[model samples]
Target: MTVHLVGAGPGDPSLLTVAAAELIRQARVLVYDRPSMDAIAALAPADAETHVVGLRRGHRALSQPEVNDLLVELGRRGDVVRLKSGDPFVASRGGEEAVALQNAGIAVNVIPGVSAALAAPAAAGIPLMLRQNSVTATFVDGNDDDEHAEPPDWHALARLGGTLVILTGRGRIRRIAAKLIEGGRAPDTPIAAISAASRASQQVLRGTLSTLPAPLPPPVTFVVGEAAALELTCTSPKAS
Candidate 1:
């Protein structure tokens, strides 16, 4: 049995990779997280067995370990399509699942998709790097579940002086901003938050580190540094 670990892109169904779509179509068992992925999940054939492991309003949510177990069980039956938001390896816990499946002797294939860390900034018209302004781009997970995971060194990050992209940081942005400032970043350093990236309902909020408004919503990506101040996608007025 083989399991296909596919990245579903950000939120737009059209962003799904051709390989991902083809795998879903042939999936005998389909597994995905979050309701936002329903549009992508719908690509599976009518007879495919489906499972939603992410938290939902009324339904019980499965822990990562449980989901891993479930995938192992399903993999024994036939080809399984496991759809993860954004790129499978980008803060999606897909690596852990892959490890679990491997330990269980299941074959696996991984398909890449666009990650929100890149898409959110682009969709909001912010470049992650500019030759003159920013030469480095750092991506970090703002929400860490493992107590053992070394906490991010905000001071070093502030001193790194480049573009910083924080995923899953919506709820703790205010605190994170404070830490950055305490770490030596300028209070007026530009910061932007983008939510529902690439979707019709996407929202972008731009401000300095000290002035960013309250968190927009969950699934937000925060861009910090000089590049955040540039709106490269803005249409210029007709040349006079």
Candidate 2:
């Protein structure tokens, strides 16, 4: 049996790739992370066995090791779908799970999807790169908890000078902003926070390194750079 690691995209059911949708539809067992993924998980066959391994109001959250063990056990039974939000590898534990499954001698397949890092900025009309303003884009995990991995170097990021897309950084945005400023980024450097991107509830808040925007709900993607100030989607006539 093979376990399919599928990207459910960024909170929108319609954003799921054709391959991802097809796999879910045929899944004999569906495993997903957050409760927010219910919409996409609903695509699986009604009889499919479903498991939620992440945080839920009444359910115990599964640790990374527990999740990997669960996937391995499920993979031996039948067709399994491990649904992850956004792209499976982008700031996600999907990679670790994949490794565990492979080491257990189970076949694994990965399906790519649109990451929120890219979608959020686009939905907010903030270009991650502009011809004369920004030529690079850097993506970092704001809530990284890997004990073996070194923490993000915020100071170095500020000095690099590019579009910075931080995933899961909503809670620590203020401190992050301070670090950026300390690293030489101007206090006026534009920043934008896009929450629930690509969904009906999507919200975009704008500010700068010195004046961070008010907190939005979870699942926020933060864009920091000159490009964050440009809302190309705005139709208002520009001052000539």
Candidate 3:
């Protein structure tokens, strides 16, 4: 038996890859994270045994060890599908799960999904990179425990001359903005926060590095750069 690790994309069911959809239909045991269930969880077989192992910022429905054990146990019985939001390897902790399953001698397959880093900004009409002002795009996980142990070189990032995409940073935007500005980013550099990205509930908030709008809910994507200033209108920012 094999355990398939699939990406559920950035909360839009339509963004689910064909392979991911098929895997869900074939799953005998469907294990999912928080965001995947919001849209594509129902795609699983009617008889599929579904489990939620959602890991939130301060809450965890199922601990990592428990989830890994569950996957191994289920993998021995039949086809198992582990659905995670965004690319399975992109901050979803799929790598650790994959290693756990491998060590347990279970075959595993990983299916890549559209990352929110790109989709969120695009859905909100923010170009990640522009020929005029941006030549590179950098993605950093603002909430990573490992990252927190060692402070990032904001000054070096400011000197990179590109766009910055920060995922899961809604709670720390104020501090992050200050760091970027201290690193040399202009206080007026455009910044945008997109919440519930790619879903019907999507909301975009516009501001600058030093002048962020009022706080929004979690699961937010923050874009900072000259590119964040563009208003292509794909999705307009609501009034702050």
lDDT of 3 by residue, 193-218 (tens): 88888777787889999899777776
Better model by lDDT: candidate 2 vs candidate 3: 2
lDDT ranking of the models: 2, 1, 3
Tens digit per residue, CA lDDT, model 2, 7-59? 88888888789999999999889999988889889988898899999889989
Between candidates 1 and 3, the one scoring higher on lDDT is 1
TM-scores, all candidates, are 0.94, 0.95, 0.89
Predicted structure 3: lDDT: 0.83
**Clash pairs of candidate 2?**
none
Q: Clashes per prediction?
A: 0, 0, 0
> lDDT per model, in order?
0.88, 0.89, 0.83
Q: Using alpha carbons, what is the TM-score of model 3?
A: 0.89
Pick out the ten consecutive residues of candidate 2 with the lowest summed lDDT: 231-240
